[model samples]
Target chain A: MPPRIAQIRLVSSHPQVYAPCDDSFALVDALLADRTKLLDHHPSICMEIGSGSGYVITSLALILGSESKNAHYFATDLNPHATEVTRQTLEAHGVHAELLTTNIASGLEKRLSGMVDLMVINPPYVPTPEDEVGSSGLSSAWAGGENGRSVIDKILPVADNLLSEKGWLYMLFLADNDPLQICLQMRDKGFGAKIIVQRSTEEETLHVIKFWRDPDIQIEGNEAVSGGKTAPQRGFDFLRSQISRLSFRETRQ
Target chain B: MRLLTHNMLASNIKGVTNGFPLRIEPEKIIEKPVDFNPDFLKNMFSKIDWKALADASKIMGYAELPDEVPEQTVVESDEFLRKFHHALLEVHLEEGALVCPETGRRFPVNKGIPNMLLHEDEV
Candidate 1:
């Protein structure tokens, strides 16, 4: 049978490279859940930041499949080893992506700014000591120091700059990382956020949030507070209500 | 790395502005077969930086693309799309180094991957 996503056997491994895990699966599932939306999105430039094994990005390309022929795929990793492994994985699936080894995306921001139409991330959401956040190799994969927001916070601004006016970003966030707060943060950036998929394993709970630019929502602090701007207020209300429901459900669990 | 990737890459060292179209120091250039899709090329034609792509193509030893950014109507032609597709996807940089324009930093490319990581000082 043909593989819907990437075959695990074909995924290259290194002692230091991070492997595909539950968070990765949940992230893919979130993309799969929104396959039709992705197809309709018609993203021309697609990218994945912190691409460990290239599983999520590869799966995303597959979900959109050959129908999305115009979309150019790019993946970046801090670890050079992860970039090599990612190349092998993309090749195994007969897909092509421009791979770069960099911290988040420092060098290419100018060229890529406001251009990426679809972006995905399976960030290091594991809360560790502050010292471990940017450690080299495998530890960098899951070390999210101090509520797991170190890398997440850094990525948010970059993602904001990279996303097109119609762009969509899918990212995995742990409950500990605080999904509600993340959603609110995105809301402040004039993006509408919703959890498309939420899964819990023995280790940790994962929420895969899909964010898109909502014109109705005003960018925080940029627009003056006005009672007449009910449309943007309603937009915030929607995000707040949706995320609050998630927190309530989690508390029940 | 293909010329398409090159068209979108720029140096991001601190205090370095206009770090685009990093100069190519090609060591091994190879052509890899890519599935041809004219529609994809047409869409990308709008997004890509024509001057950088043409310059990079010339550097990689393919000179089919025009020097100036052609009109969007030109992208509709099959001949134009073919050249656009070839320069964008077919040519690959199997091994080389991308030299940053602002700072003479060399980011090595091996096995078709570009290491854009900056050194501690560069960062």
Candidate 2:
């Protein structure tokens, strides 16, 4: 069998929908890289937020393969057209994901809390005027108000709540998103964060970070961060080194 | 929208505390065949809200599933698995409205995708 992924030709589109681009490709690559571990993890509930063109989620379902027949896929988008386009894309791939037209997981939060085993997101990380942050049309896909963090910040806590004890989250970030600070934020929440995949293109540099709960850091709430900056700071420094090494390897190839 | 999706959604209109298992208002109901994986059903049995699913399934016109989850022995049986699988995955509320039980807010489902977006006033 050919690798199970939605073909670009098969991927339906709408003028208002965000099409798969470099950022989307980078997100898929990150998931593909972790496919082995993901299969081993046997995630029961898999979800994607902002599934534009359905590329990343389709690729993820493909990567998981039938060994994960037990896995139920879900996706959400703020744009209704995007949701429809996502449904078409998933159907074309002979796979299905429960698609919802909502702002994040608003309607599904209480029921799905602490149940999602794997979550992926490629959120709007483009810094734009605040007014454009939630514009009605396609602009909403890429318009992230002020430092491109307006939406990313909102998504983080939701991820924390929705993730199961063994849940894993993979998210994309632009270099300007201050990935180090984001990692530190998650660390304070008792999540261990890592930069799984990093790629720099002419337009922008992208990093796909993976996060999971760290039992070691699950201390009493509100008292865990007194002097917590050092460890994750060290981790950030190490991540920087890894970034450089990976880039060097890429250039050599 | 599949009943599985229905089981997990609620009217999340701010201030409505108990908007779970949004009441099914089916304009049309369809059954799309899904590959029945007993393993998946078995895994989800414990996590699922039994009452919500039973009520929602009956509303969607599939009353095959028991009111409560059956014992482990019954759940593993082929007959129970088929009914559970049919109720959970195959049945789709092709065009419908999921009404919040408390506030009676209707979240519409069109072309199999539910519009769970809240209005500014509702939010």
Candidate 3:
């Protein structure tokens, strides 16, 4: 019998490519939790922005299974080595995705805009020197620079442009990335976001947040009048409490 | 390089806008039989650019696809779906160059892998 998700041995690797780690597992766990919604959504096209070792995307393909016959999968990475590793990984799993070695789907805009039904990203979210943001090899995989928001910031607008009317986006961010502010920014773009999975290790706290287009949220301004005022207030309070809980956990450790 | 993969590729040179459906000039092509999944083909019908796929198939020497997808509700036709599956998945380019339709830049394909890396000046 085949595994329900990607087996660790099947995930290919290269010296330069970032292998699957705690954050990657967290992202996969979030997808598993939302598998029911994803199946019902019936996405025609699914894409992953920064595929490293092809773990998350391949896992997603397996999770969807043959039920999603109509879905097309694509993945892109800045590192050429990562794409190669991803190809090997997918081949090992008997799954397939169109792999491209490009900078965050650069040439894809004209064709893919407003057509992608789902997008997933695990960006470089570790704060480092600004100059180190796009450095070579493995460093590029983790260096986010300035609160780890540089790459995440660039991805948001691109996601906004590429996502279909009913598209759903799942992304992982660190506590230092200031996820609450990121949620507000996406809110301004007519996206409703919720924290799907939260995990704190000794070194970092990872938050896997899912964003979907909300028409009511789009019409309402920063006042948060769309889902009624109470919902917005509750969201803010939840974020605040999560931040404090994460900080408290760290300090106690 | 599978045609399905080729269908999504576009040359990302510095100033090329219409770099879609990159021309496939195959030096060596191989055919390996893969299990036919009818539902997958049916799902892919609407997403594929039929004209571009027909052109690609014609170039790769498997011109079974029509200029436009048949209007006779062919999605349920096993014969049609098998042809679509063979053209999209089984045909492989072991060695080739994907020429940019707009800029004429040639990206080499070696060992079933495409090298889409660009130089700093080219980008």
lDDT of 3 by residue, B1-123 (tens): 778878767787888878998899899999977667776677677767887888888888998887876875776788888888988888888788999898898988866767777778987
lDDT tens digits by residue: candidate 2, B6-121: 88888889899888878989999998898889888888888889988888888888777788668889988999989889988999999988889998878889999999988899
Instruction: Give the DockQ (2 decimals) of all models.
Output: 0.81, 0.89, 0.42
lDDT of candidate 2 over A129-179, digit per residue (tens) = 888886657988899899999999999999999999999999999877878
Query: Cα miss at B114, model 3 (Å)?
Result: 3.2
Question: Which structure is stronger by DockQ: 2 or 3?
Answer: 2
- Candidate 3 CAPRI assessment class: acceptable
Deviating ranges (above 4 Å) for candidate 3: A1-3, A219-237, A244-253, B32-43, B72-78
Stretches of candidate 2 off by over 4 Å are A218-237, A240-253
Ten contiguous residues minimizing lDDT sum, candidate 3 chain A: A218-227
For candidate 2 chain B, which ten residues in a row score worst on lDDT? Answer: B61-70
lDDT of each: 0.87, 0.87, 0.84
Question: Which digits, one per residue and each the tens of the lDDT, describe model 1 over residues B14-57?
Answer: 88886887999999999998888987787677779989999999
lDDT of 1 by residue, A59-170 (tens): 8778778888878898999998899989988989988889998889877788788989999999989999999987778999999999999999999999999999999999
TM-scores for chain A over all candidates:
0.92, 0.89, 0.92
RMSD of each: 2.2, 3.4, 2.9
Each candidate structure's TM-score, on Cα atoms with residue i matched to residue i, is 0.94, 0.92, 0.88
lDDT of 3 by residue, A189-228 (tens): 8788888999998789999999988866644455643455
Who wins the TM-score comparison? 1
